[model samples]
Target: MRIAGAALNQIPFDWAHNIQTISTAIAQAKAEGVELLCLPELCLTGYNCEDLFLSDWLPESALAHLQQIRPLTEGICVVVGLPVRLHQRTYNTAAVLRDGEILGFAAKQFLASDGVHYEPRFFAPWVAGETTTVEHAGESWPLGDLTFEHLGVRFGFEICEDAWRPDNVRPACRLRGKVDLIVNPSASHFAMSKTDQRYNLVLNASRNFTCTYLYANLLGNEAGRIIYDGEILIARNGHLLKRNQLLSFKEVDLEWADVDFSTPLEMAGELVPLPAPDEYRELNQAMSLGLFDYLRKARSRGFVLSLSGGADSSFCAVGVAEMVRLGVAELGEEEFKRRSGAFDEAKTEVVQTGAGGAAHQTAIDVDNAAETQNQKPDTANQALVNHLLTCAYQGTVNSSDDTFNSAKELADSIGARFFDWTIDEQVSGYVGKIEGALGRPLTWQTDDLALQNIQARVRAPGIWLLANVQNCLLITTSNRSEASVGYCTMDGDTAGSISPIAGVDKDFVKKWLRWAQTELGYEGLRYVNDLQPTAELRPLADNQTDERDLMPYVLLNRIERLAFYDRLAPAAVLAQLIAEDPAADAGQLRAYVRRFYQLWSRNQWKRERYAPSFHLDDYNVDPRSWLRFPILSGGFSEELAAL
Candidate 1:
């Protein structure tokens, strides 16, 4: 028997569109001569429907859509996910239909009720050893653990979280009788290091059950809350039969070996079950998928960045270019600006500065400097400032040669239009304006957060101006590590339409940059990657490293997962940290614990205000969606006092 699996892009709360998408897939499967097709979990209604599940009309509409799809399954067996209401309780269920008849159904047993998911609040657990049959359209269909025989192969069905349990489908299917194949229709949310575990589990389960395994997942943004990675894997007898690497809408067929029910034990010998490892392949795939879908779904033309000669901005530029390259091949230079809104008419004029401020002398000095340096003088600071102002903005009164040159080279390499503008005079004017507004001169010290914020805040208007003029989206350059401990300024470094690398830690950002340089051959990225992390707000003497200001990102991420998401107490988390790093000091641990709670709590307000960020892992801090914390609560002072 030939089986096909489709990874579909599902829209949240859009029943008509979802049915149309499913109809297209069914047509494709039929064209491919597929007898049985497995779609993602909750294909009718979106998986991350949140409170929409509680609405009476949602289930009714979803059921109607499912009925509309029933006719399309005339020649093929289709398993689709939908919420089934039974006596006022909802069950996350999958219905198998063929030839306009319901064969059987399976309910999700293992509900993900913690972290970013609260399935238990909406769905009632399907009690084990219980069976029920429902009459739909005058036909009675059996529910719970049951196998359907078609073409001499006994097939069992399960939902997303159901397969995650130890004895979920295996024992039940074994108890019922011999089954040749098990298909899991899932809507698992994206999380770092999850895909590796998922693939391993599927492979191990196939070996343990001695049956063919078909797994299909939902993809794209669901309700703008969670990103689902679409992966379809077909495995048999401890070996992978076929897999699709692209974690979006796609299809795969696996018909390598026939399932023989009589000799099921023969295939079980090849199964090797090992403990799940912490490989982050799924996280990477999820990140890339989020980027791709956000760009496409938002109908965004492209992205633009300031392209500072620093780690954060440079990393963002590289990530944007990489996303564009991967999604669309050889994205040309013109298309970049056209899509990014970077090529609008100049709104500002650029003024070149000579040794003192004469245009003729400045041009002559530029020539002499170029001749002496054996480089194009016009291509240096002054020329860069001119290009930036003309292409990216309207007016620039002064320009810097060195900074502009570096930015130009970086943008050129990434196939983006590069412009340089010197904001020395404008920045000084803004500083004066801010000082006058406050009627005080600012001091330079640790207590000068307001003063520092002004500097960062001033940069936003012009960049935003450029973004708006060009019809392009600005990419925010804050990394996950810094965001954990509140190291970013609201509307400053945090100002952008999307945060591409917010899900990645500082250490991982460096690693990805290095990989881009050595493997991707983007040498301009190497300069930024090699430099030490700094905000570059003050002079070199005020050199501030992010790690010095906040806890180490790796440790912070682990602590966040364990303490916050896993619900481990402070003392227990400390014990785990000490065991992992024996050199951790009492003072450092106490400070991190205190600061983590403070920043985490205080940043809820900021996180809530942030633009929609990609959901790359299970540990996201999107307050409006994934996580919800009271913004006006008393800070972590009371919690720390208890410790």
Candidate 2:
């Protein structure tokens, strides 16, 4: 028997789009002669519908949509995931269909409630050894913990989180000797190096249960914030059979392998390990795909960036370039443009006229005659990038020449449309107005933070106007490290539609820029990578730096992980930091820890107001998704005093 698993990129409650992708996968699987096919968990309605699962109409609509897929399974056995509502509750279930007839439904017995997942809030766990019935279209089908037989072979399910449970409690343990195959449908979010753990889980389950195991996952940024890698795996009794290329820029990705259930399996060769994953490459692909999906699904024209020529903004600029490079490589140019929703031949004209023509006439335009033609003619990827990315250097009087060159060169190298404009005039106007209202002149010594923040804040309006004019998303440059402790200016640098690097820390951002410079061949990164990381909002005489304002980024990230990810208290975090960095001074470590806790407590409001950010790592500080804190709290004062 030939079995297959498909990873689908679906939109939430978008009936037409979801059904089209599902139909495409089923048609492709049937063409490949796959007898048993398993789709990702919640593929019918999409995985990230948030609170929509609570609505009876949504689940009823999903059930109605499932009927459309029934006829497509005329000659094949297909297992598709969807929410099955019984009584007043909902259950995450995989329905088995054989030759256009509903066989039965295997409901998930485990619910994921940890970071980035709140499944238990919406789905009730199916009781073990229990059977129920669901009625649809005047016909009833068996639902709840169940297995089915097709073509003399029996199979069971572990819908997404069910397989992640303990070996003793997971559904597969009970189906060990009872079933010949175990299929897992998942909507696992993408995180670096997480695939290795999943690979082991599937292969070990098949070996322990003495049955063939098949796994599939959802694809792309399905609804925003969460990215799915669209992985597919097939294995039999400890022997790996098939695995698809993960994070593909495709709507439907399918992989299959032949399994001989009647004959004895040979166990001569051990399961060959998948090549070690390079995190840099993984992030590049995940971010590229995430951006592509966001640009198209949000129905936005493109991305507008305030390219500060710093680490965070530089990383984002390169991300857009890589999006064009990787997307065009996978889906051809025309399809890539069509899927992006806003990229068209007219956009090319907009770039030539709007971006180019306007630059020639403004006094704020710092470009010389030679710099106006920075985008090369022969590079098709660059030309596509020019349409998709529009960047401006919103410089102040305090901005440096090195950063200006960094932003321009990098944008030019990647074929992104570049503009340079100074916000000094606006900064002065705001400062003078504030002085008149207060009847006092604000000096840097008395109001240093306000002085620095005004320069950053003044740059927001012009860039926002540019983004609005182009119908593009404005990219915010704040990363996870800055978000951890209120190192960022709210409504200033933090003002944007999306924060791409908000999940990753500053330490990683710096290293990634260096790696991108040498390995990824973005030579334009050399400028930013050479300079020290600074906000550059202060006068050059101050020689301000990020590490001076806060602690070293390495130590800051350590404290953040301990405090949030590990859920440590203030005293415990300080102890852990001292133990980890014993060579450093203990007093300064204590100071940094106290500062982190205070800033983190006060910044909850800022984090609450931050633009929607991607969940790239295992954890993030997004209150809506991973972590939640009160906007008003005690600020950890008592605990800090003890430290």
Candidate 3:
């Protein structure tokens, strides 16, 4: 029997679009002679519908849509996921339909609860080997974990999280060799090299169970935060028969393969060449796709950033440049422009190399552009950036001339519209008013934090105006490291619609910045890379650097990972670090550990207040998405005192 799995870019509660997309996928699968097809989990209500699953109306609406969709699956057996309510309890369920008839419902046995998933709150796990009749659309149908047969082929299901369970609740019938197929509908989000893990699970299951495994996933930035790579894998007898492209820009991506039931299966290694894990390259690709989808979804004219020429801001700017270059390369210039709200018939024309997929020749290679001077970048891809990204450098008395030059040169190199403005007088306006209220002049010696924060805070309004007047998304410029220690001002530097890179750490950002400059051909990035990471909010004479402000970024990340990832205490962290780095000073390490614990404890409120950020990896700092820490804590005083 031939089978198909479809990956879709679905929007939440978009009933009309969701119905049309499902119908289209079904028709295409039927046309391709696919006897059975599987789509991603929660394709109807959308996987990102967080609290809506609690609503009775959502389940009713989903069932209503399912009835309309049942007619569309006339010729092929389709497994579609949606929320099913039984006895007022919701279950994450997949309905099996064929020939315009409902077969049965396969309720998910495992609700993923880790990291961005909160499925357990909304869905009850289905019991294994327990079969019950469920009332649906005025008819009773089979529910619970049961292996069903269709046209001489036995089929079973392992919904999104079920397959990952260490103690799988598969009925004895399945292990006894009665099941010939295992279909999985997943809304798996993208993380660096996560596809490999999915592959291993699919391939191993198919080999061990002697069945063909079909896996499908959601695609793109579905509900603003998590990005789906739209992966579709078909593996049979330990061999990957077919796999769809990852991170596709299209709305619906369906991959199909012909499965011959009569062929004797052999347990063997994979024959296909598995791609090596290049997370840096993959990260670049994922970020570009995510930013583009966000821009389109927000329907903003473009993006505006307060570019300080630091790694964080440069990363955001370069991310925009990549969105245009890489997007144009893949979709072709016309399609990219059409999707980007660029309606000018003549404006979207990009020079195609006609060399297969390498259409845009301007991918950040330094040798490509020797001139560092400010001019409309000779690169063809710069035109797209010029149209989409507007950047400004808001300098103050404490801001250095180096950052200002770096911001301008980088903006000019990338063809982004650049504006230079100084807010020294404005900084004094607030400082003077506050001093007047206090009946005394504020001195830097007594009010350093307030003075520095005011400098950062003063820069927010003018750049905000740049974003507002231009109708663009103002990208915030704080990284995970700074965010961890509350190194950023509350409403100052943190003011923006989205914090794109806040999920990632500062050490990686600096590493990526250097790599982007020297290896990735972004010559403009070299300036930022060369400068030491400094907030520069303090006077130049003080030589204020981010490292001096807190601990070293590398050490901070290590201590954080040890504490958060490994769940270790302060003394344990110090001991581990000392053992790991024998040459490092023990006293310094202890001090760093204490600082990290104190800062992390006191800064939970800042993390709670950050704008919605991208969910990057397994260890996310975003309180809403992954990690949850109490805003009120003892600053780990007792934990530190023991050390």
Q: Top model by TM-score, which number? A: 2
Query: Which portions of model 1 miss their true places by more than 4 Å?
Result: 15-17, 86-88, 129-146, 168-178, 222-225, 237-239, 246-265, 270-285, 329-406, 422-434, 445-447, 469-471, 551-562, 565-568, 571-593, 624-643
RMSD of each: 7.8, 3.7, 6.4
Local distance difference test scores for all models: 0.65, 0.88, 0.82
Q: Candidate 1's residue-wise lDDT over 225-253, tens digit each?
A: 47776777788767777676545422122
Which scores better on lDDT, 1 or 2? 2
Give the count of colliding residue pairs in each prediction: 14, 0, 5
Model 2 scores a TM of 0.96
**What is the TM-score of each predicted model, taking all chains together?**
0.79, 0.96, 0.92
True-vs-predicted CA distance for residue 52, candidate 1, Å: 2.1
Q: lDDT (0-100) at residue 6 of candidate 3?
A: 97
Residue 273, model 1: lDDT of 46
Query: Which prediction has the highest lDDT against the true structure?
Result: 2
